[model samples]
Target: MNKTVIIKGMSCRHCAMRVEKALNKINGVEASVDLESRTAKLNLTNSISNQQIIEVIDGVGYEVVEIIDV
Candidate 1:
């Protein structure tokens, strides 16, 4: 499964890395973060809900503006 999440407060490469690391640590998550676009693309090995994704974002001190399947 794939997901695209729009994130807020990502102003630099460091912020992107932090978010990427946070997401990647979750079981079943493969993640890539784009600082320019402030977005994260995640590939999951199993089912995960929107709320769970949002929680991950929030847990890392970012706000999730949206999540899309692609």
Candidate 2:
């Protein structure tokens, strides 16, 4: 499954990397963050909640604006 999350406050590559790392910490989740679009593309091999993803991103000082299953 794939999900696209719109995020805010990502200013640069470092910010993008931070969000990517936080998402990747979840089991069966692979994330790539793009600062240009202020979005994160996630690949999931297992079930995970949208709130979980939001919390993870929020925990790292970023904000999840929206989550869309794709």
Candidate 3:
């Protein structure tokens, strides 16, 4: 499944890269972040929960403000 999450605290390309790296560390995740939009789009091969994603983001010091179901 694929998902898009609106994230806060990303202010530049470097921030987006860090967020992407953090999400990619998840076993089944293929992710990318757009600095301009401050959003992270993720593709996954297995079932994953929003809480888990939130934890990952929070663990890396960013906050997830919204989970978009696209």
Clash statistics: count for each candidate: 0, 0, 0
Q: 19 in model 1: Cα distance from truth in Å? A: 0.3
lDDT of 3 at 47: 88
After superposition, the stretches of candidate 3 with alpha carbons farther than 4 Å from their true spots are none
Stretches of candidate 1 exceeding 4 Å from the true structure: none
By TM-score, highest first, what's the ranking? 2, 1, 3
lDDT for each residue of candidate 1 in 15-53, tens digit (9 for 90 to 100)? 999999999988999999999999999999988898988
In model 1, pairs of residues that clash are none
lDDT against true structure, model 2: 0.95
In order, the Cα lDDT scores of the candidates are 0.93, 0.95, 0.91
Clashing pairs in 3: none
Per-residue lDDT, model 3, residue 50, is 97
Q: Give the TM-score of each candidate.
A: 0.95, 0.97, 0.94
Q: How far is candidate 2 from the true structure (C-alpha RMSD, Å)?
A: 0.5
Error of 1 at 7 (Å): 0.4
lDDT winner = 2
lDDT over C-alpha atoms for residue 35 of model 2: 90
